[model samples]
Target: MDRGRMELYNLTLPVGEKHHTLAFLGFLAGDGAPAQAIELQARYISRLITGKVAPPTQKAIKHNLETIKNFSIVRKGKFTYKVPLLKLCDLIACEIGVYPWFWRVFLRDPVLAFMVWYGPIFTAQYRLLGPDSDWDRARAACYRAYDVISANGSQRDKVKVKRDDVTVARRRQVLLFTCGISAMFALGYLGKSRNLHGAIAQWY
Candidate 1:
């Protein structure tokens, strides 16, 4: 395993020795109760990824979920049970290079891919672009950061900065800015979707 190649596709599995996080993404494609059904969902996703009938222990799934949360890949709401898919974070996980992993997931199951794609973008547009949202202003800041990073090196070097632990640590300011904005976007969509009507938000 190449420690320097820490992008999503190359990294070791977070649970069940497979892409359980991809499975978790599929679970979030619907309006499922994530907290309640995550264990069962983890089993189903593990089976799909590794072709293993056996499920990982609950503790392992929880640990992985916690790790992902720490990464700001998924956000839990305070009132509503819905998890904001955090599209930007998902995009950044691919590390400014190859297309997102969700796009690859699309080849195997277009419908699931569509839901995952549609849900996050829709929720983001609906909530993040609302009149009260500062997303426009936020994007400007992100672009400025993007400019600074782009100025520092070529695209290849940028990729190295993203994947190499030593480099990312050295460029901690950029990493934090990326993470901080993602959290803002995630938090912007956090709240009850009581009136949200769509396959993405109310597919129960």
Candidate 2:
């Protein structure tokens, strides 16, 4: 923990492209942690800054983050923070090309491809809808996650949109249709007929 915390202030340490990666882990592990999630980030961003995290310089900390990937997440008392697994870092970086070092590993397998395409289907679903949420909330979170993936997939925009839009659009449609069908399988898992009106409103 000391090493992880110290590397942030050690300017001698090279902060690389993966700099914003830690901020993501802190947010994920912060769930249900006693301290507000922002607090976890403040402490993290104190040494490292990335993404939408505040009070950070535009200075890159990716190398700084790399210094500590070997350290496991430490949970003390009510605090929870982590240096994301190197593999996780690779997945996050693959789209943006944060670290080219890990690309070969990512392309090595189809399953890894899935993680690249869609992360946890409902990262915030249970929290937002309770542990046993109904299909409606499940689908809501699924859609939200799918939207995130689809948006990021298009971030590169190397190909002209006129050419890529149709392709990306097809992928989006397939993903969303898959999401709804997956949701259907869980029908009545939380009581299917609870309220169609509410579900329909969210379908968009």
Best by lDDT: 2
Each prediction's Cα RMSD?
A: 20.1, 16.2
TM-score of 2: 0.25
- Which stretches in model 1 have alpha-carbon errors above 4 Å? 1-46, 49-54, 64-79, 87-204
lDDT of each: 0.38, 0.39
Backbone clash numbers for all candidates listed:
0, 8
lDDT of 2 by residue, 46-165 (tens): 433434323324343453344333333443432223433333333332222222221232233322224434454233322222222353454455556667876787758576546554
Tens digits of lDDT, candidate 1, 160-195 = 334565663455556455656864665456534334
TM per model? 0.20, 0.25
Maximum-TM-score candidate: 2
CA lDDT of 115 in candidate 1?
Answer: 41
10 residues in a row with least lDDT, candidate 2:
124-133
